[model samples]
Target chain A: MEFLGSNWIVVVFMVVATFIMGFAMAGISSVVGPSRPNKAKSAPYESGIPDIKPVRPQFTARFYVIGMLFVIFDLEAAFMYPWAVNFDVLGMGGFVHMMIFVSLLLLSYVYAWKKGALEWV
Target chain B: MGDQPIWITFIVTFVIMIVLLTSMAYTTWYERKVLARFQDRIGPTRTGPAGLLQPLADAVKLMGKEDLIPEAADRKVFYFAPMITFITAILAAAVIPWGGTIELFGQSVNLYPTDLNVGALFILATGSIGVYGIILGGWSSGNRYSLLGAIRSAAQVISYELILGFSLVGIFIITGTMSLKEIMFRQHETISFGPFEIANWFVLSQPLAFVLFVIAAVAETNRAPFDLPEAESELVAGFMTEYSAMRFALYFLGEYISMIIMSLFASTLFLGGTSGPGADTYWPLGIMWLVLKAIAFLFFYIWLRATLPRFRFDQLMGLAWKVLLPLAILNIALTAFFRLIGNGQVF
Candidate 1:
């Protein structure tokens, strides 16, 4: 707990340093850079065409599905890390436990594959 | 923990921040030089002798350019987006163990900013958070190209991050630790082969994991061959299409710094970071070795950018989910099997 507290101090320092650098650069440019906003200049670029349609078009559902799958697998991977780190101490019981967990996840992966959820098209 | 004074910690953090910013500046020059050499052209030679001062010139030009925010853009998010990206990228460096502790004015000082017990997990979390910058930047721009680019980046990062996480499982299994400093110490053991003695780097025993890790890392950083998010010909600079002036520069700086951090992470994980001959006796030598290893990885990153063509979006996703992810899992399982057999505990 003491070590964690010290580490948080470093983390806070890092956050402060990053913000300072970022804002300082932005502030310098705002002071030095010229600004003249016009109808054409303020317009978002669309390859010299008069802007048509809303920018946020609906994307494919495949992306959403992939994201959901990613969340699931990511959780599985996170759980496995601590288990893997303590493999020696956990011994045979831990080994069996992880294998069962992995096998179930692998089944999900196979089912996803068979269902074409992995396909980008 | 060394229980060092807070002032020393601040000083070290300041030095690291300066060094990282300078390196990020020079990396652009390095990339241009290497890419030019690949195409048999002299790149940026006129900007102050071999273009050593090109980044300075570029920064000055950027500072003087008009800072434009689209009239239809979300004012607050547009301004805040680049800051988020830059912060996450820079913050990951806090946990990286650069070298062994050194004595300064009769006091011992560790090379890194902080020694987090959950170092690797912190890196992963920060990396994931960085995606928010791209997503917000693209969305707030109110540009079609920017939104498309953001979506692509979201998918690409998510896919590759899985492989990246799993690839390190083998190393964690072997070392029984996630703290980078502890892992480095564990790697200090020497292994002999007849006439030669070599440091027991994770790369030697877990070559497959190392290879997978590098590939995943390259994709995670969104460099060439997997740079679908920023494909210029198709998306007009992708998610960054709507950004200009300092905002664009912040994103650019973040990308390069993240590349350096990824290289440092790789070297520390697999190359017996800062552990070389005479390193234990003299700490500065360890820092040199760590820097050298990171530079090699950075060069390899540039080389790949020059050599490989960008992957199609679908192809990139397929490679990550189908090929790399499975391979990473298999690598972990293989490592476990071997470790169990070594310990005579296999059933």
Candidate 2:
């Protein structure tokens, strides 16, 4: 019991329990579940309908560009939240930390912008 | 509950575990509903009264479906992937302080399952390990799409993990503690608001960090706007392309649980978790307040899914490595400098 109350033990219990339950449930479900094989049924379905088009084709690169830009700004934006929450307690030190982080990220953003990574139609 | 601290821990943990599992089930339902709303259509209102029983029905169907492992797939690694995912998700919850301590039979037990000193670090490590499940699952699938998904997932995680670690470094520096509980207590302390006093919330002090955390967290969980790993349109359900039946469900549960864990961490770290407006006024209420706060963040996640678009893969990587990482570094330096200044010491 004392061991059970310990942090490490509790963590162990949780890890083990979740895996076991998932496995057990999965195992039980698979054991009694129906199995029927057919060529049409096995084939992949798209948008709730049978697929008639080719499997792969090249798409535009614009999505990648915008995605890169979004990710860059999105991440840069995330670091600010924690720094803002602890601003007063951190005072100058915290602000300085944030400034450095933001500035460095800002530099990358600028470079990306110059490289035409932010463009979209 | 008296003279049964161990038993109590078991019961509480079991109940919490059940709650998490059930919540994860419904989160899928929620995601579908939200996604449909975004696309402007009615989603899953057919089964069990407005689709309330949809998740349960889905579970039953998944259970009843045939289990399949491609003959070419590596049996060992393929089997282990979902297990790893499930395990890592549950590991993060260990340090979450669900509520403050409660008195039971004249003995007080902390509301959290565990209070490890390196709780934050533990979470980070667990998150790192979680990526492996995706990687291995994709690799073992022996499918090109699955392999590509795994590669993308690996790159995504690696890109974001640095920024994620950097963001937390700021929090650690400010709180001067790695323990989540300590950070929570530090929040419990207050600052003067003129003649009156106001309980310090991290949101006010660390807004930048909070925002960064939310963004990085969303990416880390591979949710919408950062869900390139499992992007259905491009990758045909990404890493789980060949996974079927309950194996698929394990991945599903792993994802939702990860989201819940992220929400809890965000609330605890930035939203003054469990430490409410008048936590000092009454101790028990502190935990209730924390739950409410965590719920708010959860809704926020759901809301983001409802409103946001998924990012391009390259864009996701660029943000993590270039933008977020640098900002996180700057954040840490700023937080350190301000703490010194606040102490009235020259640094």
Candidate 3:
């Protein structure tokens, strides 16, 4: 709690610093930079040919699948960290508990693999 | 730690910010020079002596160039995306332990900006947030190639992030702490084998985790071989294809700074940050040691960029999901098994 209280200041400072640096750079460039926006210049670059369709085309479902799997595994990894940090204190109980958790996750991984969900195609 | 004067903390934070900005500028020059050596050609010799001032010249040129916005672009998202990238990249530095505490003007000051109990998790969280810059930038640009590039980047970062997080579980297990400062302090003690003493760096004990961490880190930063995000041949400039002038520079700055941050994290986690020989006798030596380790990692990143060919997109994703992720999980299991047996809690 004490750490959080002191560190929030640091966090706020960092956030403000990032914004200041970003805006300062943007402002300087905008002030100094040339602004000659013509019709050809403003169009999106597409190998010199004009764009025919809208940019937001339908993407593959694989990306969505990867995202779902990532969330599940990322959560697993997140849970494992706190447990790992206290492995000594947790002793045998923690070891067995983590193994059970991991084994269940591994089963899901295997199921994903078997179902071809891991395949990029 | 909370008792320190707020002004003093601000000054320290400002100094670190300056250092990060300067280093971020020089890293581009460093990469070019090193890449030139690897390719048997001289790089950027015209700007200043040995091109030491090339970054300054480049900054001036970028600032003077036209700031272009595409007609079809989402103006707000396009403009702020780079800012998002730059912000997240810089935030991760707040928790890094640059060195042990040192006495300045008869007052002890920690070398780190702020020490958090969950410092490691803070880094991971910030890293995850960085992807938004790429995704939103690419999507808002109204360019098909940019969208494809962003999708590739999003997938790459997400997959490898798991490996990166899992790889560090070994360190957290061994040290019994997530605070980088505590981990560094833990490494300061020497371990002996037969009559020889060795620094108790996590790299020596957890070699697999170190390897996995480095691999995933490279992918995480979207650097070469893993640089499918900005494959110049295919996607023009990736998410920054529509960006020009300072907007593009923000993304560029974000990339290099993230590389440096990852190098710092690697050194802190595996190489016993700031804990080299002679560091105990002179505290400043600890900072020097930390800087040296980080530079070595940065050089390694540049070397790999110069040497390795980029992987195909499918191969890139496959390596992360099939190889690195599983290996990371195995590493965690192995760590748990050894720790349990060593403690006489299993067997």
Per-residue lDDT tens digits of candidate 1, residues A48-119? 887976666568999899899999999999899889889998877888889899989999999999999988
* TM-score of the B chain in each candidate versus the native B chain: 0.98, 0.92, 0.98
Indicate whether candidate 2 or candidate 3 has the larger TM-score: 3
Q: After best superposition, candidate 2 residue A20: deviation in angstroms?
A: 1.3
Interface RMSD (Å), each candidate? 1.0, 6.7, 1.0
Give the TM-score of candidate 1 (chain A). 0.93
Which 10 residues in a row give candidate 3 chain A its minimum summed lDDT? A1-10
| lDDT tens digits by residue: candidate 1, B1-347 | 47788778878888998999999999899889988998999899888989999999999999998889997798899999999999999999988887767888998888888888888888988999999999899889999889899999999998999999999999888988888898888788899968999899999999999999999899989899888889999999888988889999999999999999999999989998888888878888888888899989999999999899999988998898899888988898899988888878877
Error of 3 at B295 (Å): 0.9
In model 3, the runs with Cα more than 4 Å from the true position are A2-4
lDDT of 3 by residue, B177-235 (tens): 98888998888889997799989999999999999999999999999989999999998
**Residue A53 local lDDT, model 1:** 69
| Winning model by lDDT | 3
- Model-by-model DockQ, in order: 0.80, 0.22, 0.84
Residue-level lDDT tens digits of model 2 in A3-115: 34465777878877887897897787669777674655554433347546433323356545654654565565455545545555666555656677767767877787678
